[model samples]
Target chain A: MSEPRFSVGQRVQIADRTPPVHHRVPSYAKGHVGVVERVCGMHANPELCIRGDGKPFQRIYRVRIPQTDLWAPYEGTDGDKLEIEIFEHWLELAQ
Target chain B: MTGHDDHDHGRTFQPDHPEPTSDAALVGLALRELLIEGGHYTAEEELAVIAEMQGASPENGGKIVARAWTDPEYKKRLLINGKDSIKELGFDLEPYEFTVMENTDQVHNVIVCTLCSCYPRALLGMSPAWYKSRNYRSRVVREPRAVLSEFGVDLSDDVDVRVHDSTAELRYMVLPQRPAGTDNWSEDDLAALITRDSLIGTQRDLSTK
Candidate 1:
């Protein structure tokens, strides 16, 4: 498997795609920008273009973002943040 | 802890359904028996764990909440990496490891595992039946604040609701902020204020109110 392109503290954005039927990615986070918090090693990639191939690929990263970035309209006293695990394929370097 | 019964085990066979246990039930029964036979735990210890598993008592979560309430530095550590921080409190994360997230005024946190029930079993014990149900997994992400309200957890409209979807590998636990009325309270007193429902985002920390 290839090493993940992104590193901790690197800014990245979620790829644009129709959500998978059974996905670990949350629906609210699609197309959002966040910073990589941790590289959670690699695992068998679940999003296979064709099913039953049994070819495993992909690394997962833990990403963090201020709550305001995800929810623009959010207004709260304490600045909150969220951390999510995103597969390699779902991320692209933010320009 | 005070209002609700800590633990209760009472069941009588109902006349409507009189049948032998199914394969699934047998498998579950055998799994428990094997655990004891393997010397993984004493029968009494197994029962205690099982009771917590059944949601009779949320021992681990209560401890986490207590530490967060009393210790500022520990709370920071918990927010960063819940699994290791909880171990510092003398709780084992062996059976099930967990990822802890915090929710503040600006952000609200909720957890769901879409494919299967992935939960912080080490800290929160076994996931509740409701957490495993499809209804919760499907609806929480779509309408988090509304769903929380149904459970009597009504957040202010301004609070951002962030729902976490756990996959097969990782599980999530939400650490709510400490309540206000707990000034000068001991760790034990603060722990008593945490409930199983609170950890799951179904209820708030009663100490705050």
Candidate 2:
């Protein structure tokens, strides 16, 4: 497969998936906007379907978002940040 | 329920018995011995890892802390995509996954896999035995301040306490800020400053002695 396209500091949102099972992506992060913090070297995509249709894809990006943004009504530390890794397929540029 | 009780009551227990090892247990023991023999880790390290396996959450937290201290950008990334972010640290999210919550001056974050010991094993090595116990999981969220106090983590009432339920694929690791004593310390020195308790939000960074 072709290398996935993403860059550091780019704004992106996690792609929403249906009937989420045990997944590495956080539920609160689904549909939430975040900034690309780092481009982690490639690795096999862990998310798999029973049919095995989605082959292992690479290009994972470390994304960061302010905790206040993730938790609405968050009245705590302002600059606190939460980071997570996202596969190329699970992200799209945020408008 | 009555029929099952009757059957159990009628069953006699045998005192003398040979313990049969489960396939899983045998395999695990063999793997552990092999790892030790190969010098992948020392007996002490193996013991530590095994003790951690008794409780899955703490080990996972250790892994995350190790990675965060080692890599700068990865630390930043962890604050973004906690679950997915760990993969960048060279950990595989397998039967379980994790979510990361950061604690700061104004806010405090704690995680509990209430139903079970849902933990970030990839980043942390294993969870503490207490973490897997039902008593801890059940009571911590209800009385966070009290529970934290038990671990000597006394937060002011002004600090916002956030409890994360690590039920789904997400587990959590607390990324404590580097301590101030070792300002010019190298990565190794910085790493030495981090203890398992600090990563789990139980204790603060070690002071320069």
The TM-score leader among the candidates is 1
TM-score of 2: 0.50
Per-residue accuracy of model 1 over A3-95 as CA lDDT, tens digit each = 779899999998767755455676667788988977765655565634753257568887776666666555432334556778888899988
lDDT of each: 0.69, 0.62
lDDT score, candidate 1: 0.69
Identify the candidate with maximal lDDT.
Answer: 1
lDDT of 2 by residue, B95-119 (tens): 3444455566777766666656766
Model 1, span B1-209: residue lDDT tens: 12224432111112244443788866765775566558786556755665555553466788887788678898888777665787887775553345676767666777877657777765676678989988997666545566788888877867766666665356667777778767888888777778777777777546544
DockQ of each: 0.16, 0.08
Model 2, A1-95: lDDT tens digits are 46558888899998877454545565666787888866755554555644464366556676776667876655345554555567777889999
| Lowest lDDT 10-residue stretch of candidate 2 chain B | B8-17
